[model samples]
Target chain A: MLTAAPERSSHTIALVGLPNSGKSTVFNALTGFRQRTANYPGVTIAPFVGWVHRDGHSVAFVDLPGIYSLSPKSEDEHLAVRFLRGELPDAPTPDRLLVIVDGTQLERGLVLLSWVAPLHLPTALVITMIDELKARGGVLDVEELERRLGIPVFTVVGRRGIGIEEIRRSALAWEPWGIPFLPLPPDASVEERYQWARELSAAVLHFPRPDTRSERIDQVALHPVWGLILFAMVMMLFFQAIFTLAQPGMEALEAGIGWLQQMVENTLPEGILRNFLSHGILGGVGAVVVFLPQIALLYFLLTLLEDSGYFARAAFVVDRFLGSFGLQGRAFFPLLGGFACAIPAILSTRVIPSWQERLTTMLIIPLMTCSARLPVYTLLITATIPPVSVGGVISAQALVMMGLYLLGAGTGLIIAWLLRHTLLRGAKAPFILELPPYRLPAWRTVLGRTWSSTWAFIHTAGTIILALSIVLWALTEIPPVSVPPGTPPLEAQRLQLENSLAGQIGHLLQPLFAPLGFDWKITVAILGSFAAREVFISFLGQLYAIDVEAAEGTLRHVLAQTLPIPVALSLLTFYVYALQCISTMAVLRRESGSWRWVALALGYTFALAYCLSFLVYQAARWLLG
Target chain B: MGQTEIEVPLNRAPLRRQLVVRRYEGESSVIERLCELGLTIGTQLLIRRRAPLGGGIEVEFRGVRVGLRLREAAVLYVTACGDSNAYRSS
Candidate 1:
């Protein structure tokens, strides 16, 4: 352990369970919103630790990863076992442990119970999914199972928050340790476990007999071909839905921002403060307003998928394709979330076990059409690509939108393949999926998480970006233009941002960027956008406002009008291959242990962006000209 | 029939007899998982539904809904007894 807290207790309870066995719901039930501390070591798939009072004393319930055994193969599985064994930093072994099992599938869920019993960590069992067994025509001899295992068992329907009082009661009465002796002999290896799983299952489990029409249909649904297709469609629908539903709200936001900017303009004095408030603040802030709907919607959709168990299906579908590039099936969920933003997505990669796998997953996630890319795409598509109806079903612009998404996917795969072949070469992690059972989307859970994420984005735009915009405005506008007496000040030199420190620096770096088609103004915007992508829009907004003579839409129109098609295309391509967001870099620093990987990532991406953009522009013009 | 004999025995009149997965159609991460879960051709499979909407159908493998794409599902050869018993059926 690299660190431990000064006031830490020597006891921690790690909740272990199989997927969809109500591990999370149980945590929520026990925690009930009072949980704040993160449990998983180095995993941002951080589960909430809801403190419980057992018999007038405080006990912390740590929700560990959902796994089936102590014979750890994957990182999450290993972590779950390790934390229980008191290996993780500041993570202590439980005074009492709860082994949550599926009420319906005790045989399978008990796979872990049998393995971990010998290790002896104050074990008890909360058999979940009792409601489902009733719904699906299966019966559980709960008392018999509990007596045989020599542990207390409580039946729970975790979502309704049911049986939790009894759970608390058991926690209070728990011996602070348990000893479960198997009537049968124990096998140690995975090979032994596999055989034990079969033998033990035959002894205790009785699967609901499959006879009805539905069973046959499921056989096909599980089919590789059909399943893959369905998976693709689900993702396509999600992306299509995110963009589709966001447009109207996005338009309303644009109107609202325009109105707000006009209000600021009318109210403020026509000076540095006013320009800062109106053009710098409003323009920069307004760029994000158009994207709020998409961000909120994407977060909402992704949280639901992650919570409701559909992500597992989608992951299985793409697992094959991702494998070709050296990523595992687990990367699917992270990339799926990356479409909206990379913050949570990158954080989620902690659930990925291997550092190499996690790095590959993290690196590729930013490519999946993040909501940041939305404003740029919408701006370019509206300006350049005309939306014409194709075949009365597909919009030309929609097709182009699909192509852009595909391009991101293509680029991500290529990068992963490159990493696999070059810097990171090892056996691809074996695919292990914990397929959670189908369940209704937890609306409360989803909404709380989604809104929290939305609020985080809002907080970022309101603070960091807001402060930076003000600083940028000042950087571009200081020294109060001392013009020669009597000359209405040469309009160009009165536009003397050159006198300002920003313009001088922009001019200095102009030569290096010239080949990539970036003029001084574009270079300035690029530098500002390094802070945030949407800052590009405001960068142009503020730059043109500096020229004073440039009209509304003049900067946007300037790029469209004055810049060659090659330059505009180059800028677009540059953003397409743009590396991590600033926040992504910070998180990567925390995760990767050094800035070297971050620099390598940025250097490679920049070089890739420049070469790719140059080739694209030169080729497009050659083909057209 | 010869191909059917390659993996598992087919039911009489090609009834969709349950078979555990022997292996996946393609050697990918997904196929490997399906095989590990006793969802191969010989394992007893409960064919799920082709969702009324698009995407894929749901299948019950080792008592879980394994949602497979149309392409993957197609390679799966099954002996169905003219029953519409899809996955998720009561």
Candidate 2:
């Protein structure tokens, strides 16, 4: 029975490989649920570390980002090479290295192996994708390869867990192959190394012919005309799935949280503890939790796309368009993921090789109108825009919602272009992408990856949101004072909120927001929403609960009756551009690895939101009034 | 049979045309990368297609497809092996 050992006794082993080589799958098989998938390429970007126990001792395994060679061209490759050379500060030097090779592309894999060979580290080889190779009528002489390289070679179908135990044993024993370092000749060029790898592969690999299915698929998938169409269709279905499929699950989660809040409110005595648990902890965390379905769906689809080898094609298709904005084609997935949530999207930018491109993508991701803003947008659209249809087809409300989404995306692209010419000016990184052969995505791999990502989000962001929610709750309920006799409960609650710290801060900021057509109540909601965009809706819900006449009315109904159209439109525009989520700022700090960038991002976005909202409000008043 | 091999830029190579890499005329980094990706002299390459709207070119070599920018593709000098029926059949 395998069990996790004490961390102090765990030996570290690093799994290295070329891109698309099934290294991550092998790591998943060895570590089980103990692993977390960071889903990015750099060593520091998403260090996926897992531990496996063997005979009372545990071995820590790190799945490093895939690279083609030791020579670093991109940031990810640089980090990977540095980590392998034990030059990365604060990272534990792996006691051993397990190099995974793609059996189907043995020659290419051998080139990378040769580079690792000169390092003379304690290393072994696990040849993967053997099933795909066998399907193409190929056979690899694993024993012969082991003899030629003087290393232990294990053949594996990582997706199905074949030969996982043997690899585990090899890691546990910490056996170095002791293969003599095959040093590169002085002044040897990449061609010479390629020749060497070719000779090595010729010695052990036998295949009747190249696999034709992948070629056939690529003909359609990479065709300039049809590929773009296919990509668009695939993306359309992907977004539709996220919106439609996740709807029921999101609703269920929301209802479940609401029920829990009500239960605690009813069962617990009415006190600070009850208030904190029901409103602060439950409400704040629930806002983040309801988004789990969308996040999970996004990861699941992305994993499938990645596993099937279509993502590279998609990147290739979009390279030209993204290049104009000073972003690499690889930034497409992260930006698309941004539509679901910016946190995972920022983490996903590790796939971009250039530091500038990755940073630019991170800066613009929050502008992608994440699902968090949906509730706010929906509420505003419902309250302000009529349900009248144009030509009996498009609803005015739906059009406004779509326009807001486009506004967010358009502003992001324009900013990307501006940043590229000014702050991020440099020669564009040369585009060199390898189109991996298409394969059927394994179900277990996709599910395991999605589960790990969902767990990571809940574990990391959930705690911060919960803590902030509690702090906000305290701010809303301070300076213990009772309502005066004969005062209406609604007015008393309003006065209590107005007198609280959160309310006072809102009042202090009212003058600043006055230009944008927001009153103190709206100002308070905006401040509260800094914890998360969705919090704006919940905060409004709480505020409306104070008005006895409007207490029984829905928050949307109350807002519809109260706020003028210009103010409502202004607020909608504000949410479109504001960096109103603390979790996003926290994620930015972590991903960019600096507070300066976070502060700059926060400062600029707030300014942009305020200026834009003020302009929209003033223009609307001039045009309509 | 050195009949003054007719060389053309890789980007100019017609789709599905088989050619042999003569030399890379690009920057050192591009040359190094091309060599690392097994596009060294004497390697066979088939131009798959030009990306839509002049984005890049897709070249097939060694059972793999590599997408290269048009400028990078222009640096590769290839000698067209006129109508290699045997290569196509294979």
Candidate 3:
């Protein structure tokens, strides 16, 4: 071991272990709210770092991604190994290592210990899940294990904070001295190492027969036929809960934002400031913020699924289907979450072990028809498709909506397959998922995770959305034109909007969209809606509301009367395929850690939308004419 | 003893049959990974269940449950410990 002077004021210790070893739970207990979780294997990934106050000094704990061995076969494991060697750029070499070993599966953990122990760092072992071990009538001789390994081994029930303080104190006082090396052949094969681990485990660990509860549960959870049925049912309920539970909170937020906008309108004098405040700032930002409850609910349910150890089984159940698409089984949850929103879905892709699979999943998640598209779909369907009942039960409009959703999902899967073969061609990573024992999710951990993700969403992507909203507002507000006398108020407003910068840009882009049967006004709405897809409805509302006195009906009626069937159909198809949401772009950039991906996603989606919409419009005109 | 031992890919093993890993038939790195998961030569594993649609197999080893894709499981060579009659019964 290399000796170096230790920094007194603060120290960094990396928490390393196998996946499902409760390392994160221990980190959360030590660091409280000072931690941040992120994708650890991606291009822009970073280890989760949290600070804890111990004694008089502040200690920062870096929670590296879990891996079974230092010799990594997957990208996540590679990252963990790199971080331990202090080779990661901008990451400090940890002064000490806190290796977490699962007490119930000591032999598996000992293999990892044999790998890490040779590094000769100031290391300590924290044996977690001891409660599970004891519940199965097992006992571990920690003192004897400590003697064998020459490291302080603390038995901790991390979930319940048992023996945590003693571990914390020992970790804080860790020094690179008196650590004995295990006696092994200098050139030990992995099999030889495993043999040594087994012998050591036998010396210090004693247990009754293995508990059969998890195995019994696995019989049902892993059944070839019933498992898939159970998985589908569970996922269906999960997505349903995301939509149903978050609806009230979403509506309440909308009302709250609407109230705030009204107060601003009533209080402020009518001017550009009022318009910018209500429409630009509040409206633009509130549009994204209203989806927070849904994002939170999606993450909350996902955390529960992951914590309960069912996620691994779900992955196992879906691996074959996912493998055919060059995706991993873990992509199932993230793709399912994409139906609610793509931002959190992208964030949750961290669970996927392969970087290639994760990126492929990220690129395709936006195509899952997020909730943000509902408003635009509803507006177009309400205007174009009448409420004729099919079989006296289902409405034709509802069927059309369902058809659009199916189209989006179908396109997403096809594109994922295509990308896998083209841009992301590589050998499929090996799948070895650990099915942790079933346990009720720690509510505190779930809530904490949900809160952090929500906050991170608002803090990082929220600002970008706010800025784009302001920019869009300015685009429509600038180059004010004078209205002639005797022009009605609504007509004057329309004239001003037509002469504005946004309108001019719309005219410039009109020729491109003209093939899709879109007018300049529709083009302007499309441009403004780039802030978010749902903004398309409000933009159309504002544009159509201009001819209020001259129009004989509601805005919907006016839109229906003015737009031909071909044009309306083209517009709906465009919105269905278009990557128009700035927040999603921002989140994608953040998650992938590459502006290149963001540009590629935007370019391809726009290209697809334009080509498909043009084809639809031409076909409709040809058929109807 | 070696000639009499019946070896098969782990993925082909019957459910509920106990097997002892003899060797891995893939890349050395793959073998190393299996060893890290306590599936080294001489380690005992019980075949739990195959996943739906031939996705993977669930196995119990070292008091933990592990899921492996069919391709990875196929690389693991193991010998059934009990009589052939017992394996056929399951």
For model 1 chain B, the run of ten residues with the poorest summed lDDT: B8-17
Model 1 misses residue A579 by how many Å? Answer: 1.9
Highest lDDT: give the candidate number. Answer: 2
Best first by DockQ, ranked: 3, 2, 1
Residue A398 miss distance in model 1 (angstroms): 5.8
Identify the runs in model 1 with alpha carbons over 4 angstroms from their true place.
A1-11, A37-45, A52-57, A172-179, A183-207, A210-229, A246-296, A306-309, A350-355, A384-403, A434-436, A448-502, A546-555, A619-625, B1-90
A393-469, model 2: which lDDT tens digit per residue? 99989889999989999999888988878887777767888888888887777887888888888877888888888
Cα lDDT tens digits, model 3, A236-276, are: 89977988999999999999999999999999997789988
**How is the predicted docking of candidate 1 categorized under the CAPRI scheme?**
incorrect
| TM-score of every candidate | 0.76, 0.93, 0.91
The numbered model that scores best in TM-score is 2
Winner of 1 and 3 under TM-score = 3
DockQ of 2: 0.52
Give candidate 2's whole-model lDDT. 0.82
Please write out the lDDT profile of model 1 over residues A351-377, one tens digit for every residue.
676678888777777677777776766
Residue A79 in model 3: lDDT: 72
